[model samples]
Target: MIAEICFTADWLERKRTELGGVDPALLERALHAFALLGHLAESDLEFVFKGGTSLLLHVPVIRRLSIDIDILCAAPAEVLDRSTDGKNRCGQSRPACQVASD
Candidate 1:
């Protein structure tokens, strides 16, 4: 189930209490993870969640600890005024489209 991120100090403290007896480090990590995932879920960009974060949720009895999140995203191609590709340092033809999200 998708969970909403809460910003209020009371809600945050309550959430910590609900999680119950968690190490401060683990609780901080979990809160950060949920907050980030909630933010991304609220965004318009299309994405595929991957890597350690995925394993943390999907795998059972895994030994390694996850400390990071990874995602792959795609956006519609668009033309731009400048080129950022190093190989296209000197444009032979027209400048390639640039993604402003960078």
Candidate 2:
């Protein structure tokens, strides 16, 4: 048999509290990654805030909960070129750097 249950805001807060709070090291790493990405983009191509990272910057509290960084490029081709040359901050391949859009 299956039981149906609904989660409330209070339940979510309890769950978050039980999760032991956010990791300081992880947050530092994420911020470092964002800085590196910004530097790489500035040195190579043009980039603008996009997706979750943009939202996180606007909402400081959200940054504590964010797990990853998101960025948008103005010159995707240039980004690809820099990434292929191993100049990207992430040091990923061009194909890997290619952003997927629907």
Candidate 3:
């Protein structure tokens, strides 16, 4: 069974002491969001998450945080389509359309 770590003041302080750089509040938020994302993508078979947030969360020594979630879907771009189940989650292995900053 997976044990859930609760966020208390002591835990936040521990993160602050260990990282010694990022704000504790930010760490809490990022970790919380990341954990949620991990759960969201748990059964997903399409996208492979990548980029800075992935790096920071997956790497034990990386204490920095990013403000975005980047993903690279393994399915071919041809399958891109939104789900019709009234949920925003992708369907048919669709690529989430995004306009890059470039």
Best by lDDT: 3
Q: Candidate 2 on 1-102: residue-level lDDT in tens?
A: 111121244544554555466554554445444554554554655556566655765763452455454656566665556643555544542122334432
Q: Residue by residue across 33-59, what tens digits does model 3's lDDT show?
A: 565455447444456677778887568
CA lDDT of every candidate: 0.49, 0.48, 0.54
Q: Tens-digit lDDT track for model 1 on 43-88?
A: 4546677877678677665344454557666644432222223334
Clashing pairs in 3: none
List candidate 1 segments past 4 Å from native.
1-23, 60-64, 76-102
Sort every candidate by TM-score, greatest first: 3, 1, 2
lDDT of 2 at 37: 56
TM-score, candidate 3, is: 0.56
Winning model by TM-score? 3
Worst 10 residues of 1 by lDDT: 89-98
10 in model 1: Cα distance from truth in Å?
Answer: 11
- Give the C-alpha lDDT of model 2: 0.48
